[model samples]
Target: MKILSDTIKNIALEIRTGKTPPTSNHEYFGEEINWYTPSDLDKGKFLGKSRRGITGKAISDKKAIVFKPNTVLIGAIGDIGKLGVTSDFSSSNQQITGIYPDPKKVDSQFLYYWLKAHKQSLLDKSKSAIVPILNNKDLGQVKILFPEYISDQLLIANLLSKAENLIAQRNDSIRLLDEFLKSTFLEVFGDPEKNPKNLPFTTLEKLCSVIVDCPHSTPVKSKEATNYPCIRTSELTNGYISWDSMQYLDEDEYKKRTQRLIPEAGDIVYGREGTYGEAIRIPKTHKFSLGQRTMLFRPDYKKTNSIFLWAMVRSEFVYRQAKKKNSGSTVGHVNVKDIKQFRIYNPPIELQTQFAQIVEKTEVLKTQYQQSLQELENLYGSLSQRAFRGELIKY
Candidate 1:
């Protein structure tokens, strides 16, 4: 193990800040140069391209400095400890610091991985201020356990790279499945915005039997298992209730919290605040209480299919309405009144049922892909821990 200061050749900070920002359409104005910021860096990977580019005029005017390829970048402001390696000639905004490794002393890929592994530790050292910051000096003080030989470093990097690739592949499969579902929805119902099929339009209130709000106040949570699970906005994801991170509520608390309504298998739960408009259909009959900042909708089965309603609310048309109705300085929210007023395009019941069947089939495949992805992620975590602790070499 060696202090980073001793092993690295140089640490360079990006000089451009608020004073000299490239024009928004720099490509049309001047010579194009790739410019990166904290947002441009993907966690634990190299940035081959950047979304925004700065003009060469900025460089010629002494406003920016371009770092050569293989330079390791670390975010010093906003999103701290985001790491990325650069390809070809590139420059970053003032918020990132570039680390150039000494070829004779350390391999660039090895440094990248080491920094990725210790990102949290680096963030921990950040000064507590209005905005968290990790300066060049703090970055230089980081301590890493480096192998004596470059070959050893390459071996560790290669193993971790393979793990990342597998995880990425699994994620790609999941994304493709989601895209398929979206395409199918468009093909069946047409765009909800345009109503190109001239489907009957109705207010969301008319299609549902009941719309109940979550308890205004937060309920007391318990770590121990209870008869009821409390569903919060955070637990709503991918149009389903995630019980993996749910909190518990005892009988008495559950009864009081759910006095307004108890969700049934076909009901839809909508997030009203923060992550607004995330709607999930209740998959089965379950004893659960709603946490704050959420709404429960029980669709009239004869009028609409539960899954179809879920898809409609989750669609861009409804999302835009939710966003427009949302208010609040710190935390935006859509009240029950606005939610009830949301307009929904109603297709035939038979078509809605068919769409539900298609969704169910797609979800089954998605679940399998998600499970595989989680397993790969776990494997990557295990390998990373072992590789850093000098345990992988023995095996």
Candidate 2:
């Protein structure tokens, strides 16, 4: 596998950083232009309409730099390797670097894929491990490996793009399954917010047998793998506890943390601070303790089903309440006092169980989709490595 390499600066016709207009100036922001942040890079290879935008006044006042369509954007701050390609004329904040590929040297899509393939290598050049920062100079000097011929570059780019599209399709399938589950919930129980079925309205305190807040202090963290995992706010993502980023606690610490009550399979866990309102039913797979800024709910069997209670907590009905009740202005967090007063639309136990059964069946399908998605992602990673090394296609 033969490959030609050059620094990004030599291949790029122009390199520029994005800038943000003064936020206090109300005249600067409108829906006129895409104002991208590091977060927007997650939308895929090509940038979509940004969540926010700036007015023409911002561009005229020299408060923001507008990049032409097809410019490649890369995260330059904490999230060092995040990437996006502009789909239209756009401006971004200071945390992104825009590169205009020199047509004679490399194809735009090829450069984008090449950067994706060597993301880890770029990450390695970050100045600090604690708070990763890649300055313009380091980023400019970053090495790019590609086939010398433009035709080979296009072939490699197209191959990787097709592979990426497959991965995206699997993800879309999983998301559709999630939507179906939500629709089923609505059909069976009606909206928790409106309670169109005229179900009994009650407070969260009466709905559960016990509601326990997590230990206020951080537990002693173990560096090695252990049977005891201390679930943190970050672990609660997209309606589930992701153990991949979990912190392990020593046996003694785990026991100490669980002194109030042990977490069980059916118990529901909610993040009260940072990513508040996201809740997940504790699965039967492992014995774990809750970390700070989280709370636990044990549904009374006589009153409701665990999954039903979890579904209500995860609903937009509760999310809106959580946001309004946030006590901290800087770091949003919901208080236990406010949480206990949350109004819930309680349907009969029988109807709740029926919804739970539907959820269980839907989850099985989602698991299959997720497994397929993981395999596709792994395949893409492998193909990317080979494609960049000039082994994917026989030239």
Candidate 3:
């Protein structure tokens, strides 16, 4: 094993920090190359697609620098420690530093996993400023221990790659289930935006018995387990609450806070600020209090199904509405008024119930996929920890 500084070759740092020439400058989409940034890197995976592209002119003018395939890209600014490997000739913005590993001394994938394993340490090296930034010089000094033989590095890379692939496949299964539900929604309800089904359009306030946001102030948190879990916007994910991450409040405090709008099993919780437009249904009755920047909506069972309402609010139609109504300079948020006023296509109660039933069935499959994904993630973490520590070879 040796320090990463000794195993790596040249570390190329890009300094160009302007927007690539727009689509107007390119003859066609083919003339543009994939331009990656810190956002494009999905932690350990290299997302080859780019939201923005660099035109041929930008590349020709030296406004963007292209790195060859297998070059490990690390985020140098804003988002620190994001890692990825270029699959093809790709250019990154100024915020990234590319590391080209020595083929004889180290494998690229091994280097990637090493960096990922030490992501937090690299992040800590960043200057504590308004926005943390990592310099190439500082990153170059970071230490990584690896085997002397490239074969060892290859072996470790292969093991970690297999773990990553399993995690990805599990994620794909979950995504496909979500897609199936969305496709079914569209097939049955028609596009909410187009209203092809000619369903009656009405404001959310019309379909629900209650539409109210939580108190705008933070509740006093308690360390004791006797307290009720407080559901915050950050805990909302995949149309459900992340119970493990919820904060806690004293029983009395929780009772006082939620006295006006306590969340029930049939109610839908909507995140209003920071991470707006995400809605999750309370799957079961629980002693919980609503945190700030979130609202509660209890659908009238006769008018709408809880699952249908959840899907509707989580749909693209509602997302567009929320985006349009969002107001804030730094962090956008939708007001309770905006949420109440947002239109939804009201279909027959029986039809909405049918969608809910389908969702219930798909949720069972999603739960299985989620459990497997979590297990794979845990296994990957364990393998990663052991592999870098030189303990994986024993297995």
TM-score of every prediction relative to native:
0.87, 0.90, 0.84
Let me know the TM-score candidate 2 reaches against the reference structure. Answer: 0.90
The residue-by-residue lDDT of candidate 2 on 161-241, one tens digit each, is 899899989989988987887788888878877778888989888999999999989799998978888888899977877
lDDT of 1 by residue, 177-241 (tens): 87887788888999988878989999999999998999889898876978688888998987777
What's the CA RMSD of model 1 in angstroms? Answer: 3.6
Q: What shift in Å separates residue 83 of candidate 3 from its native position after superposition?
A: 0.9
User: In candidate 1, how many Å is residue 232 off?
Assistant: 3.2
**Rank by lDDT (best first):** 2, 3, 1
lDDT of 2 at 363: 88
**Which model is ahead, 1 or 2, in terms of lDDT?**
2
RMSD of each: 3.6, 2.6, 3.9
10 residues in a row with least lDDT, candidate 3: 7-16
Instruction: Give the better candidate number (1 or 2) by TM-score.
Output: 2
Cα deviation of 280, candidate 1, in Å? 1.5
Q: Weakest 10 consecutive residues, lDDT, candidate 2?
A: 386-395
TM-score-based ranking: 2, 1, 3
